[model samples]
Every structure is written in structure tokens, then in C-alpha cells.
Target: MSAVLELTGFVLTLGGWVVIGATLKNSYWKVSTVHGSVITSSSLYENLWHSCAEDSIGISNCRAFDTLLALPAYIQACRALMITSLILGMCGTLLTLLGLKCTQLGSNSENAKSKIAMLGGMVFILAGLSSMVAISWYAERITAQFFDSFYGGTKYELGYALYLGWAGSLLSILGGIFLTCSACKEKHRDYKYAATRQGKDARIYIKQSETVTSAKDYV
Candidate 1:
């Protein structure tokens, strides 16, 4: 049962990471203004890496930025953070796989395996947090720019990509939490078993000592 829970968490986390990566690559973090509820040429959509425009005739075009140095500080930061999170997620997934009870990679002992699983869970949690911060930071900047009265008349609305990011972050967090719980439960069981063994050994030692004393008194 615990193994099932761990696997479920791991799969969910991986799914979340995939979604986040796809969303980041997608040029739909925000969509340009819609006119009369219809998307026109001015309906531009953008993501961390590129921007796209949709025309009234249903033509869509996209272009990646030619340069990164020219990008805004928030954009640069978002890109960096998201990339970092992806890296972390990759590493965490490997660790989780190795530590899984169903795997024998690090199964020298249940205790050691549990520790590895816990470590993987921690990495996954960090990956989730990094992605969350990046997405939230980018969203906040957008919100600020949109609501700013001094800002130009050009308007943009939150896009599907942002929603995907939110969903991905949530799933990653939940999955990591599940994995952590499983690790903790394993650790507790290990400790309990060790204690039981120690108690039994102590009882046997006492019995041996009592037998020795009786033998001496009889002699």
C-alpha cells in the first residue's frame, strides 16, 4: 500500500513537471486584447520564451526572442527559475525511482531506502517551490503592469499557460507531500521494529543472567 502511494506521488510529480515545461514553452502566458469578443491581429499571446499573434482571418504567428539580454529582469528571472526547477525535478525523479520499495537499487536496508525516498521527496518539494515562485513572480508583474493607471491602453489577460503552471505547481506540491509522508511512515516502522528487537534481546540476556545466578547458588 505504501509503495502504491509513493508511486502515485512520483507519477503525479512527473506529470506536473511535464505540464510546467510545456506551459513555459507555450507562447500563451498572456493574450492580447479581444475586440467584440473576437480575436484580431492585435490579439497577441506571449510566454516566457516567445510571443504569438492571432489575426482576424484566424492566422496565427509566433516568434522567439532574438536576444535574452534585452529581456526584462522579471522575464530573465522567470526563465532561469523555471529551468532550474526542471533540472531539480529530473534529479528528484531519479532519486525517487531508485528509492522506491519496488526497486532494489538502494535496498540495502529498509531504513536506508526510506532515507533515500525522503531525500527525493525533499528535492521534489524544492523543485515545486522554485516553479511556484517563478510563476507567481511573473504573474504578479503582469498584474501590476495591467492595473497600472499610467500604463498604456494595451491590455492582456491571463492565458492558459498560466493556468497550467498553477495546476502543475499544485500537483508537484501534493505529490511531494505524499512521498514525504510515506518516507516518514517507513522510518517510524523501522524505529519501532528496532526497539522491539532490542527489548527481546534484553529479556533474553536477563534470563541468561538469572540462570547463571541459580547455577552458582546450587553449586
Candidate 2:
């Protein structure tokens, strides 16, 4: 059961990273509003690195951001956070692979494997939080822009990429939690086994001492 849970968690964490990567690269995190009540409308879509506009005729044009320094603070921050999360997720995946019981890397002892798994879980948690922070920051900015009354209101609506980011964040968090729980259970079992062995050894030693004492008295 533990193995299943750990494996599921690892898979979910890996999938979450894939989702986040796609979200970051996608250019549809937001889409421009349609002015007409028409069923079909042309709109602009944008992501962290680029923006694309589509016309009613289905022609599309895309432009990448010219410079990182010229980007807004939120954009810069989101990019940083997302990249950091990706790096951490990669590290965590590596650690989780090593920790797997079927693998030989840290399989010398159950304790070692558990510790490695726990470390991976910690990394996953950090990665998840980073993703969540970036997404929330971007969402907050979008909300503020949308509600702005003083200036031209936000012309965009929340798009698919943002939803994907949210789903990925949730998966990472839940998977990390499962992995952490497995690690904790393994640690507890190790402690219990050690205590039982210690008790048995102590009993055997006491019996030996008593036997020697009785033999001495008889002699």
C-alpha cells in the first residue's frame, strides 16, 4: 500500500511539473474580451513570454517580449517563481527515483530510502508553493486590472493556461503530502522494530546473567 501511494505521488508530482511547463510556455493564459454579442469573436492571447492576437479571419500574429528587464514586476516575479519551481521539481523527481524501493541507489537500507523519499517530498512541497505563489500573483494582477475603473479596463479574461497552472499546483501539493505520509510511516515502523529488538536483547542478557549466578552459587 505504501509503495503504491509513493509511486502514485511521484507520478503525480512529475505530471504536475509537465503541466506547469506547458502552462508557462502557453500563450493563452489570458484572452481579450469580445465587444460584440456575436457568437464568434477574434481575440488576443498572452502568456509570460509572448502575446498573440487572432483576427476574425483566423489570421494570427505573435510577438515575443523584447527584454526581461522591461517586463513588469509581476511578470518578472512570475517568471522567476515558475522557473525556480521547475528546477525544484526536477530535483525532487530525481530524489524520488533514487528513493524507490525497486531502485538500488538508496535501497541499501529501508531507513535510507525513507529519508530520501522524505527529502523528495519536501522538495515537492516547495515547488508546489512556488507555483501557487506565481499563479496567485498573476491572478491578482489580472483581477485588479479587470476591476480598474480609472483607466481602460482589462481587455482580457482568464484563460486556459491559468486553470492548468492551478490544477498542477494542487496535484503537486497533494502528491507531496502523500509522499510525506509514506515517509513518516516508514520511520515509525523502523523505530518500532528497533525497540522490539532491543527489548528482546535485554531479556536474553538478563537470563544469561541469572543463569551464571545460579551456576556460581551451586559450585
Candidate 1 lDDT over residue span 121-156, tens digit each: 888888888899998998887778777878765667
Candidate 1 positional error at 11, Å: 1.7
Off by over 4 Å in 2: 35-40, 217-219
Backbone clash count for every predicted candidate, in the order shown: 0, 0
Candidate maximizing lDDT: 2
Q: Runs in model 1 with CA error above 4 Å?
A: 35-41
Ten-residue region with minimum lDDT total, candidate 1: 33-42
TM-score of model 1 vs. true structure: 0.91
